[model samples]
Target: MGFTDFFSDVWDTFSHPSPDADAGGKASTNTPSSGTDEESGDEKDVNKDDAKDGEDSEQGHKPSGDDDEAEEEEEEETVDPKDELEEECRNSQGCAQPKHHFDECQERVTGQIESDGKAKEDCVEEFFHLAHCVTSCAAPKLFAQLK
Candidate 1:
């Protein structure tokens, strides 16, 4: 996604959560709406659905794992650095690790980028610049344990 879309998503997720989200996505419609004014029957139905959802969560809410699958699919849709890195390492033997453990490295790198208040690409570029010391190292002792 472009930076605009990505940030818009972040803002949307942060700014507006379901009212009952913190309450485990449950709300009691029978407890009465805060409305001093009359609510339509359709509005009442929506409230009832929200209440029912809350009740379902309180009882037993087993996620279908679709969220997890969807997130995985979204990540796959993004340009993967591992693929690029692997392709870059193809010509040289022992120049890079047999495998790239991106998850652990990415977590740390992303955290640092956020904490340092640097652009994501800037941090990533710096990481690659430093990481090349290991990837292209001649000495086994100095070799980056990339896995």
Candidate 2:
């Protein structure tokens, strides 16, 4: 057969397997009956083994929703160190003035942008002042906690 025909046959065999065939695309040797009592008896034994396996698998497997909820709870419990430090710095007495100045600058800049479609000045200086204050307060505390 040509290369395309060979691939097409392989795909068809995999996608639409015969009822009497195993997963490997070979005809099953353990046919239920061939008009013989012996083959029928063997089929009964095989069916019993399959039922036992199904029962074992059902007992072992847990529902997926429990795993998802457990994972989400774990994620919620964990907090990043950088975010913790930023919050601490924002709440510190040392950073209060700079934080206020930065907030005011941001509000003014946003208003200018809305009314004039652009602001002549960005709040980079105010942001830098706030960042500097936070860093000054946070760095010593961070280094003290480290090994």
Candidate 3:
């Protein structure tokens, strides 16, 4: 099945769960009666034809490989701009000093915790300093891109 259909089925299964859902969370395979014997036989014939055509008869749809690949490519190509900007700013020269300070503080705090079974001080302040620097550097670029 296609992605949206799969998700829709999942949502339906959760939101309107069957009474016969087992303790293991699996719903019972017994489908409710829909029609008479002749109608069921007609449906079976259609299902057999669909199976011969290499289509997913149960889902009532077949996904093309090209469409699936194109969708995946588009998803992969669309990176969140804010995340990209933040990563760039963090690695930039303007934020390097604060990042280095945060790194050193983190190492010192971790070492103290390992040796003394507790840390005398945390790296929160240094981390905030680094965060502030990166945010300041990224904000202008991010806004520029938005404009």
Best by lDDT: 3
What is the model-wide C-alpha lDDT for candidate 3?
A: 0.82
Q: Taking the tens digit of each residue's C-alpha lDDT, what string does model 1 give over 73-105?
A: 778565755555545564345433322433346
Give candidate 1's error at residue 26 in angstroms: 49
> Across residues 90-125, which tens digit of lDDT does each residue of candidate 2 receive?
888989999998999889989999999999788888
What tens digits encode model 3's per-residue C-alpha lDDT throughout 37-132? Answer: 434556789978878876533465676789898888788556789888999999999999999999898899889989999999988889899889
Where is the poorest 10-residue window by lDDT in model 3?
A: 30-39
State which candidate, 2 or 3, has the greater lDDT: 3
True-structure lDDT of candidate 1: 0.60
Q: State each model's C-alpha RMSD to the native.
A: 18.7, 12.3, 14.7
Residues forming the 10-long window of minimal summed lDDT in candidate 2 = 30-39
